[model samples]
Target: MTHMSMSYLSLIVVTMVIGMGASWYVNRQINKYLHVPASMRVTGAQMAEMMLAANGVHGVQVYRGGPQQDHFDPRNNSITLDPDAFGGTSITAIATACHEAGHAIQFAQGYAPMKIRGALVPAVNFASNAWVFLLMFGIFMQLSGLTTLAIVMYAVVVLFQLVTLPVEFDASRRGLAYLKTQGISQAEQGGAYSVLRACALTYVAAALTSILQLLWLLQSRDE
Candidate 1:
């Protein structure tokens, strides 16, 4: 391959390494805090409900499930928490639960970024699933137009990843702010912050990796 190709490949590799490292670090940090119970002794589900009610965000349901499967589904206006986070009264559980609750609050408040991200979801899914196939077909057929179209589709996927960063960060910010103002003590606030911040870093890393991948794809197309 050309020197430029190798350089782009190196950039992708470096970003992947960094992203993986951040993911590992954040998971470790979360596990560390998971064993330390919150001072208020509230389960993750209760904390989520409390935060949503405090924010005047109504009609959102919180459900318990497996670990690391916690997410706020805007479609159903529901929040699903992992077993550990839902049933555990730890700082990690409360912090994550509140973060998901923050998403519900954003939905109720009609947060612009979240709305944009939600709108892009279907397009992003299509782009993610079809881009590689299109690219391969283009290459096999030696069709530059098809290749360009594939690149455009992949770019949409990257845009989705970029837009997700703000939504995630805003949710964490709202969650942390709510925890501080609510019953969370100063010491507990610090712990919650650490957990939320660590979680946010994973999103940041993901965005960076996606951006780098897009850059690499563009460079390769040029070559």
Candidate 2:
């Protein structure tokens, strides 16, 4: 194998380690708070509904989903929470539910970053699926043009990740602030903070991994 290929492999190993480590840490943090009931003893779904109502955000529905699949869907104006997050009164559940509510609030307020991310969803999806195939075909055919095009397409994916960072961070910030301001889950604020912060790190790891992979691809093309 070539030196560049070896280096790329090493980068991949490192990136995978970081990604897995972040995921593990986040899960651990979440689990730690999952059993600790909030002072208000509100279910995740109730908490989400309260947050949305507090923000004067109407028309957004909250529903139950599979484990760890909680997210706010902009297209449908709905927030889907995992079973635990939808029914549990634990600190983790409330915090997570509020975070999704934060997204709903963003949509209501027309947050610019969220809007940008929503706009890029289609292009990002296309680039993510097409880039790898183009890169492999380019490498096999020894076509510099195709490789360069692939790199450009991959950059779109990177941009989407970059935009996502601020959106996620802002959501967490808003969620935490709402919890504290409303005196809900006040006693469990620390645990909620930790859970959200750990979750944010996964996004950081992802963006960094993509950047490293893009660099490796660039080096391969130059060679």
Candidate 3:
């Protein structure tokens, strides 16, 4: 194999390692904090509702979802949490539920980055699904223009991932800030922060992997 091909394989291996490490760390954090009780003693669902109310956000519903399904949906103005997060009073529950509530707050407040990320969702979705085929076909057919177009499409995906970082970090910040306001014990607050930060790392890993892949694609095309 040529040096370029070896470098490409190395990039893939590095991306996979980073992605797996991030996933494992986040899961470990979640499980570790899941046993630590929060002082407030409120379920994750209630915490989410309270956070939304504190932010003067109304008309949003909170639902219980399956495991690892916690998220805030802008389209329906709803927050959904997994069974543990929706009902448990553990630090993990508090952190995750409020983090999602932070997203609801962003939607209500029209946070600029959040809005921009939302707007890019459709294009990113299409690009993510279509780019691989386009690139493969372009390369096989020796069409420079098509390959360039494919790269451009893939870039949209990378852009969306980049924009996602701010939205995610800001949400975690909001959640932690609210936890502080509630006078949570330092230990509990620290636990909450750990969970949120670990979650954020997954996004960071994803963005870095996408960036590396984009760079590799550009380099390959150039050669």
Candidate 4:
């Protein structure tokens, strides 16, 4: 292989390693934070209600969504807490619920950045899931005509990831500030920071991987 090709290959490998390691590290820390609760006392649902009321934005609802994962749906004005978050009352749970609540507040207040981020969601979802296949298929067909198209599609994925960075970061910042203002849990062991930071890392890793993959795709764009 040419030196140029080899250099691109090495960069891809390095970025992938960083991306995967960041994800794994963050997940492990979130789980560890769940276990080391400064306050397992506040249930996620209860915390949601409290924060919502504190925010003075009524008519929104909080409910357990089901197993595994949890999130907020702005369109419905609902906070979806997972079984772990809703029932476990771990520090992780409370912080997570609060994070969702932050989204709700963003929606209610008509936060411009949140609106921009939300607008990108469908495109982001499509780019992340579909554009990859399209790129590979174009390559497999040896369609030089489609190479630039593929890169452009994947570039959308990278842009979406970039947009997501501010959205997730802002959510966590709002959530953490709420926790601190309310004095929800004692500062150090509160795990509020830990949970929020872990969540941030997930977004960071995702953004990094998307950018890395976009670079790889560009380098492979056929001659």
* CA-RMSD of model 1: 1.6
Candidate 1 structure quality by residue, lDDT tens digits, 28-61 = 8898899998988889999999999888888998
Question: Could you give candidate 3's per-residue lDDT for residues 1-223 as a string of tens digits?
Answer: 3978899989989999999999999999999999888989999999999988888999999999998999999989999999999999999999999999999999999999999999999999999999999999998999999999999999999999999999999999999999899999999999999999999999999999999999999999888
lDDT of 2 by residue, 23-128 (tens): 9999899999999999888899999999899889999999999978899998899999999999999989989998999999999999999999999999999999
Best by TM-score: 3
lDDT of each: 0.89, 0.91, 0.95, 0.76
Stretches off by above 4 angstroms in model 1 are: 2-12
By lDDT, who's the top model here? 3
**Candidate 4's C-alpha lDDT?**
0.76
Counting clashing residue pairs in each candidate, in order, gives 0, 0, 0, 0
Pick the winner on TM-score between candidates 3 and 4: 3
Task: For candidate 4, report its TM-score.
Answer: 0.84
TM-score, every prediction: 0.94, 0.97, 0.98, 0.84
Error of 2 at 27 (Å): 0.9
* Candidate 3 segments whose C-alpha is farther than 4 A from its true place: none
Candidate 4's residue-wise lDDT over 23-112, tens digit each? 787788678767655443778888888888898988888887777568888878888888888876777887888888888888889888
Residue pairs that clash (backbone atoms under 3 angstroms), model 2: none
Question: For model 3, where is the 10-residue window of minimal lDDT?
Answer: 1-10
